[model samples]
Target chain A: MPSNIIGWARLIAGVLGLSAVAYIAVTGNYLLTALGFAAIYVVFVAALNLFMGHAGQVSFGQNAFAAIGGYGSAILTANHGWPPMLAMLASALLAALVALVVGQATLRLRGHYLAMGTLALGLISYEIAVQWEQVTGGYMGISGIPPLSIGGFAAETDRQVFLVLALAAVLACWSVWRLRRSRFGRAMGAVAGSEEAAAALGVDVARTKVITFVAAAVYASVAGSLMAHAVGYISPEVFGLHMVVVGFTMLYVGGIGTTLGPLVGAFVIGMLPEVIRGFRDVQDLVYGVVLILILIRAPGGLAGAWRR
Target chain B: MPEATLLLQFLVTGAGTGCVYGLVAIGFCVIYNASGIVNFAQGSFVMLGGVVTYSLWHALHLPLAVAALGAIIVSVALGVLTDLLVVRPLWHRRATMFVMILATLAVQIVVERLTLIVVGDAPMSLPPILSRGPIHLGPIVLDTQVAFIFAVSLLLVAGLRLFFTRTATGRAMRACSIDRDAAALLGIPVSRLVAVGFALSAAIGAIAGILVTPTQYTAYNLGVPFAISGFIAAILGGFGNPFGAFLGGLMLGITQSLATVAFGAGTRNVFSLAVLLIFLLLRPQGLLGTAKT
Candidate 1:
């Protein structure tokens, strides 16, 4: 339970992730391509942990923010020809603004009401992405999105994208670690544990909760932007209720409260198909059954076992 | 058809859809009342009813009533299974509400995937319990299925009201909902009541599924949307109020229908969810329930 162990675990995870990318890039394996894409989700699951694990709110609607971020960047860069950097920044801001509005509106609802409200909000965002074809390009999605680049070097290949995604994931994890140790992060923990007590302790409960919500939103938006550039195409289908569940699963399976939990959760969930490669026909079924067992027996996640 | 008749047709369809949602919402309210948990897997119960009934009536060639009865029994068993498998273990651990919600969501995934593996991915449907036709009354043309749905929903609401107000078991459940410890002290078997609440909720969801599947084909993934819309309806009518859930469902159904007419089908979900968000902000107590103190 020592803090140094978590720090070491995170450092090891980062090193292993980079090595995996290097291995995949050298061997040119087809299967490892998924790991590259999964790097973005590592960022997402970590972001989700900030809200659900650190801040203590259950939101089934984080997919809405991803859609906002994904579509916002895709439209600006793909359609308006904005620079990828500018579009990414602009989309993250846009998604944050939307999150602010949504969080302000529904954060007052206690418990499951907030969960349902967020779910509804996510579905609404998805509807907008799908139906507002003039902007989102409908189901066909926006394609030929420019890749992320700096100066002379463009991330034109999967290896470069993976490296970029890895940096972002590391950055996200570092920031969350910093946040967890900050005064604001402690307030989030207090608010999550007990809103009334936090308020009595003068923590500005609503404001702290909203801040965490916005932070998570920005993380998701940034991840979404990366996803847009990586795939060079974006669609509403990419962000839906299904992704929301997947993101939640990653956080839970990893362990909810810890900084290293989301990373571990995302890695395990992302690589689950490879782990269950023999159950090709019933992969989804087996995955689901394992997930249920985990939730029932080891609700704390893999990290939970370690903590115990 | 005249504009008035066109409007009436839309309203009629909306009412039918609302009835289905209300039925599901009532299920949500029942479970919510018994346990503070908002069962996200309520939708799977709906799917179970529709799919099981379809297989029984069509594949096994059972009588419609027999198939429907069998489907209801399956739903009740699944409801009990859910409590045993997911809710009880977590409740014992004293996990947070968020954990319970995640657990139910996991259940949703497990149930949907298992059902898909067994049933295949193709959508299935059943013939209407009665002969399929539209009933014309002046300017309004109503599908017989819609009329049946409305009738059944109303009957359910009334029956549930009587059950809660007149029956001893129902009274015990109400007591359990108000205070589990107090009810237990009063010699009411709180755990048994919770199981009954879930089973009853599941049975109601199944009935709604059976009623609707004749028209709208049943599929594995259909439950989440049903759960969402039904939850919205329950919230709209005020959680834990069965009659309120019914009314909320009807209102949502009508609004969705009208919204579809105005903004197109794609915006239907957006319109309903938007309305729910607005309502939650404005009147969190819902239309029928007293304000939470």
Candidate 2:
């Protein structure tokens, strides 16, 4: 198993996997819808890896940014009549702004404190989404969001939507891959190793953490917007704590620090429910058990193990 | 009711729920002290206490008192099992804090799903222990259940204080919290004590659930919300400080009740979460806990 051979194998497998989903989507099968969702989650998990795996931080609040992007895109496109693409970009910026403020306040904390702070941030966003009935429609949610489009070419069909989502997912992964090799990515890796040590080495640990946090938030926001456009509906539950749980499962199962881990984890986890739909009552139980087993047996995740 | 009376009523109700949060927070502190792991499954013990008691009393035709005791026992056993099956292995591996947290969360989800499968997800409740209507003290109306909560919580806190100060095992557990390696070197059964800590916390959480279930509903899904609130309470009281967690819980409960009155019930969680964010940012040491050096 030469390293280069492994790399080429992974690349080919990724292309083949995406092609399979695209084929299913073109043939009007429903599984591509799930793949579409997996694509959105890839963006989330990959961005999260930048912070958690690369920079050594914990945040239970990425869903907050997703909520912001979701509601932002929903309100902007559905109510304000902004174009969907423009709305998505605006929502991403808004998420980044919110993340900047939150990250500044919270990035000072380490370990469990950071986790708890982010968790609160997420719950606050959820509560607002549920309570702000006039704008968000409360639990009823917002629907009829315009699909993603560009200059008279709209992603109207499931295939087109999946294509758009797959592109975003690929771009998200590519950026993370590139960033991991860049100087900033090295800084993140250093910070993850030891913040005190990184600081001693002249890395601006605080600034690097804040920037990465904001970037992750932006990623989550875009995913949220894509979700809204793809599903044509947006609800508070779409970006709730469950999203955090699912994202974590994917990130860990695929390999937290690995480049292809998010994509692999997202697809495997996303498809798991459908695979075990018969055991609907025990779905969460299985997920929890599988997660624990993976953590104990293969903490590096599938992608990480493959690299080994 | 007059304005002051309405305020008093909210405070009384808030105190009742606060006591439950305090108990759950204490559970968190106990486990954290013993094992340096925050057991996210603490709330599941509370859920089990209520749900199991409901089944024993309603379906199995057991006496309510016996059922409550049985529920507490079951939760304690599950807590020990969680530590032994989940925490101990990871503890041996010296897993990172992130992995430890996620493991407990997974345990919590498993417990919740198991509860759902065995008992179903519909909300259940027990009859109030006192079975009397609300008690009137001046213009303030307090439910008999609330009074019961106060009595039990007081006794438990007193008992906990006595155990820690006077008992050898309790002191050993405290020793482990300060320094596990040192405690082990000093011949304390640190591993057993960790299980004991889990059992003690689980019992407290179960009691809280049993007491509160009479006032409201207990469903499988309520565990996460209670866990979040309890975690906030722990932070507010200062993490790993059981007494502080109790006070924090009371404060959080009162503030939430007041917020519900001021705004609507819908904004109650928002207010509490806001308090959490504020506290985490400004006063991470909490009210009673000293700042870590």
TM-score of each: 0.91, 0.94
Cα deviation at B108, candidate 1, in Å, is 1.2
**Model 1 residue A40 distance off true place after TM-score fit, in angstroms:** 1.2
lDDT of 1 by residue, B1-293 (tens): 58778888899999899999999999998888787778989999999999889888878999999999999999999999999888988888888887788778778777887787778778998877779678888878888888888898899989999999999999888887687788889999877787888899999999999998987899887888889999999989988888899999999999999998887898788788888888888888898988753
Model number with the top TM-score:
2
True contacts kept of 2: 0.65
Pairs in clash, predicted candidate 2:
none
Q: What value does the lDDT take at residue A123 in candidate 1?
A: 74
* Residue B77, model 1: Cα distance from true site in angstroms: 2.4
Pairs with backbone N, CA or C atoms under 3 Å apart (clashes), candidate 1: none
Off by over 4 Å in 2: A1-28, A278-281
For every prediction, compared with the true complex, DockQ reads: 0.60, 0.65
- For candidate 1, give the docking quality class from DockQ: medium
Candidate 1 chain B, run of 10 with poorest lDDT: B112-121
